[model samples]
Target: MKKTLLAVTSLSLLAACSSTQTVEQAQQFAPCTFPDSPTSEAPAWVCDVIPTDLAAGALGYAKKSAAGIGVMRKVAVNDARVQLAAQFQTDVSNMFKQAVESSVNTSTEQGAIENVVETFESVTKNVVSRSLTDSKLIVSQVSPAGGLYVLVGMDKQAYQANINEVVDAASQEQKLWHQFNGEKATEDLTNALNSLKAM
Candidate 1:
């Protein structure tokens, strides 16, 4: 009886240990990316880098491609889920360019651009474009600034990278703009850019 009881206990312990090990070893994965969108289970760096408010807006505008390479393309302007793309996009970009120029010590425009590239998302490759009938650049660069939510899907990595890039840029500057205390130095920096023209 004593032997049987010991055996049962040992079996239970071994089973629990085995399951824990399996779970730990399981290959965790994500999916393909579209334009301004997020992948499943956002990475730690994402939260650490981009502000939630800004990330939400940027992710809403991205889309992932079916063909691999983890490349994401933008959807049409008409099809944009987040309407503020016109305002927020430009604001984020301009801020990033300014910030990079200030900090990174460089000589050529190309070098500076490279620094900007490392710091922010590549807007050229990740844009969803449309020719507006109005003979003007609709949003120019920065989209409107506000709360934006990005719907996430499974098996998307490139899409997630796109979100990470933009969000990272926004929050990166947010930190730089702050001083010792809890002060918002660049308040509503993107607010005016995202607002409607006084017509």
Candidate 2:
């Protein structure tokens, strides 16, 4: 059986870092940097996510769409499965950018607020049952832009929540993304993480 690309706990570390740049520093905010096939394709379960130009009014995505592509690519990427981990970052980054654009466009100053998609992968169920021993959780927040992101990832040692608790922590009622995917037809990060397996 094929494996699920994301473990989730690894993503727990994703935190809401207050803007390092000042309001004046961000004067040169350029979002439309990474440009690719506004139309994208992938596997079946998470495949049909081609975006229908969400770049219309208050929620436009051209600028941030480009930046998201760049940031996600610039992340430190390394995996034995990838012939050259560096190259893989670019390939995977492009795919992720496409997924983001297909799901949510950079139409607003807030960026693609939040996105989550899921696919039934033939992963070892045990993968979700572990935790990174020394991992810690912090942060609790509520925002108008809906900028909550929960990332779960597990390394060989243990499991961990990818996004910081303060940002997208699992609350008393529901898991992060699981709870986020409600009645709305919004972008899904679960689907993006599902395809993280580089090989």
C-alpha lDDT score of every prediction, in listed order: 0.36, 0.27
TM-score of 2: 0.21
State the RMSD for candidate 2: 26.0
Per-model TM-score on C-alpha atoms: 0.23, 0.21
Candidate 1 Cα RMSD after full superposition onto the native fold (Å): 17.4
**Model 1 off-target regions past 4 Å?**
1-82, 106-199
The stretch of ten residues in a row with the least summed lDDT in candidate 2 is: 54-63
lDDT score, candidate 2, position 125: 15
Q: What C-alpha lDDT, on a 0 to 100 scale, does residue 199 get in candidate 1?
A: 7
